[model samples]
Target: MTATAAFEAWAAQHHIDAPHIAIKQTQHAGTGLFAKQAIVTHTEPLLRIPNDMLITTKNATHLHLTEEFRNTIYQLFDGTDEMHLEGKNERLFLKLFLVHERFVHANDSFWKPYMDVLPSLAFFQENHVLFKNYAEHLAGTTLSVSISAKQRALQNELATLQEKACGWLDQITLEQWFWADATFWSRVVSLDEENEAVDNGQATHLALVPFFDFANHSLTPNVRWQRDSQDNSFLLMPFEDATIGAHDELFISYGAKSNQELLFLHGFTLSNNPEPLRLRLPVTPFLAGPSQPAISRFLQQNAMEPFVAFGYSHDSAPSSSSQVLPDFPIAHQLFASTGFTYPSIVLMYLLALDEDDGLRIDEQENIVLGNKQVDAMDGVAEYTSQLEHFKVIQLRVILLLLDALTYHHGELSQSIPETTHPSALTNHIAAYRLEEKHSFECAIDALALLREELLQEPVVIQYMSSQEQQ
Candidate 1:
């Protein structure tokens, strides 16, 4: 049968109601679901996919296969080769392998119709250069680290799988496995809490819901989904009082994700994602010398660690109406938001002592030894007197961050061309890089504003002693 005929047969076998929606190709978004008629607000489910029809790790465990095949699959699933697969989940990899196997021998497979409808490997391969440049340009950012780590893990898994497959590796290439991985990451949805399988609690239980996967993402989605308790099926419903006009494509929210995350996972970026840009700062520099033990103890006491994150929203897309002042108190606020309290703690330490004194613990009480003058004052008074010093340190930190942002912005700005001939893949990569470049530029601008704002603060005027006034 033709691919469409196979899909229609599969939908018919599952009793998919076809009157409400139909799958169609869009000029830009590939294949997506469009409304056949006006879907009323708060209407009943547009689609209900039964549990048995869902492809999941739980289902994979029970698939009928030869003893050798099952054992190898289990070994891969268990992740016994820990050296290569550290900190990676094996279930998704194993499930994809089985799906690939089934697709190869389609005569005996149950999911041929669904498998046939999946986009080809070429669709994902076209963006290789973009992903490569993204990794290179965003070298130190969290998003870059995450992408690199995942790529490494995928490479290791494919190597191991290929080795174990013995002569069968000819059937599925590493590229095919990558395509499956991308498909799973982009389209799979977690099972509802009420429908979660027991063994899959630690790992999120996911399934590929056939027609539901076609709904493109929107920041402001008009539709929501839930599990039907009665039949153990997934039910796609409209968000409260939101109506879908006739011929309007259905859209669902993928949660409040950052542009980096959207681009990495879904191959697209939102032009106006409201999440603030965050910069991760290592705490190792602050923990050198005698301060290490004291810093460690302080972090232990406060339930924190050696890394801290600082972030700011650009005025153009402020995460909130209230602006965050770049001041001494902002460090405390940063501590509260991220568990990285080292910045505020280090500032206090610097304030209580002269630079020559260094950080030393008192023999009597494990307290940080400092200039006896500040130590004589009460806690609040001591901190208040150090405001100017703290402001100076804060300025230094902001400048360092701005320099890093400027470096990334420069790298990205130089990588893409001035223009490109319009093709689907080139257009997509252009849009993705544009969003990334814009985010970097916005962050640089925000940091420059913060620097200016900090320089204007009255505390920047060094405090003068009576002797100095002579």
Candidate 2:
């Protein structure tokens, strides 16, 4: 099928209910899931991982077929089964969960190169049992057919994808790398019956969804939640007083991200020689439905509260058995300085149907919509005021980020003497006349994007070298 026809057919088949895929000519970002009438933060469910498809393992490896692994895959599919010969089974097993273009057009190894840079994946393979990236995301990872099998007519294009997927697994397996606390660890589960675990000790495969793929990482953002003792169905709406632009990306502290993963992706170099300074905060905002008194009193006292999420252990000990999302007091201290915070939740939604779709929210309750429960899709009326509250909190966070800067000139500047070299820091004197300029610029950019107002903002340079100005 032609690309347009294919995309439309796939959309229709998968349940893309929009009138058509809206393409933006200017923005580098590919197709975006558009908003019909200012979609506000109702915390409506979007995409999700199926529990049954989850193959939670202690570690993922790619060593050449070990005797134990071979036995397992053989027993699972009996290994020699001709079904592995490729055909619909291969596509259904692996590619079905990936975006149609990459799945059909790329090799399995094709994804490995892409996966190669993922700190979380690297950390998991090398360090932990398993890690995930983007519980919901686009074609971040791909699954290809084992090329030795039957050749599809689209081999040159899609076959390459298949090849890449395999190559990716091989290298990671060979190196035994792993990533701990980044979004790379958590994957949205795709339900494909044909894709079963091969006895050969390969990392269990996962699926990725497109729209829910917009999540970006941050040390902080507005919004918070925790499971209430009485209310199992955690409805995460924005704070009543928060402000949001028409098109801002609503991110709150739903989950804790790994510092190792953060270091890898954002280029933050953690000091092995010196530990992060410990911080203490007297007050923290309790989540909406506080089961514990500790979090409750903190929230009650703090005017603006920002909660925390626990990243995985760097030591690689057996992951904390208790699944309870814990708070990081240090993170809260940073936010308490700003006056915006409330209790919130890190919710996990799922795909209930086989088709692609979104839901409409009538009441403040969960109803099955589309293939998953998209949090942003529930009409804005229910949470507009709260979202605005979130926006105000976000502004305060941005200001805090600005306060962390060292500006010397009208331009922006950032120089971490430890992570950066003397030369790099020296070079920036021309750009920033005042110490605060650099931090303010970064915070501005960071906050603008979070508020979904990236379009109107001027280009704020967080780190500009002296030579670049010439």
- Give residue 256's error in model 1 in angstroms: 1.2
Q: Across residues 1-470, which tens digit of lDDT does each residue of candidate 1 receive?
A: 77766786778687765557777787766778888788765768877777666665565443334444555555655644321221135445444544455456456655667667766566666543224534443443445555776777777877877675554444666566666677776776667443222232353555667778888888677777788779877778877767789998888877656555566677665656665444444455545665457546656655655554544432343222222223335434422222123354344444334343333466532434343322321442345335546655555655655665576667666665544445554555565566555555555555566567667766554432322576
**Candidate lDDT (C-alpha), each:** 0.57, 0.28
Error of 2 at 447 (Å): 38
**Residue 171, candidate 2: alpha-carbon lDDT:** 26
Q: How many residue pairs in model 2 have overlapping backbones?
A: 100
Compute the lDDT of residue 407 as modeled in candidate 2.
24
Colliding pairs, model 1: none
**Per-residue lDDT of model 2, residues 173-230, tens digit only:** 2112212112232333222222221221233333332323233323343332222234
lDDT of 1 at 419: 42
Q: Give the poorly placed runs of model 2, Cα more than 4 Å off.
A: 1-13, 16-37, 40-207, 218-242, 252-254, 265-470
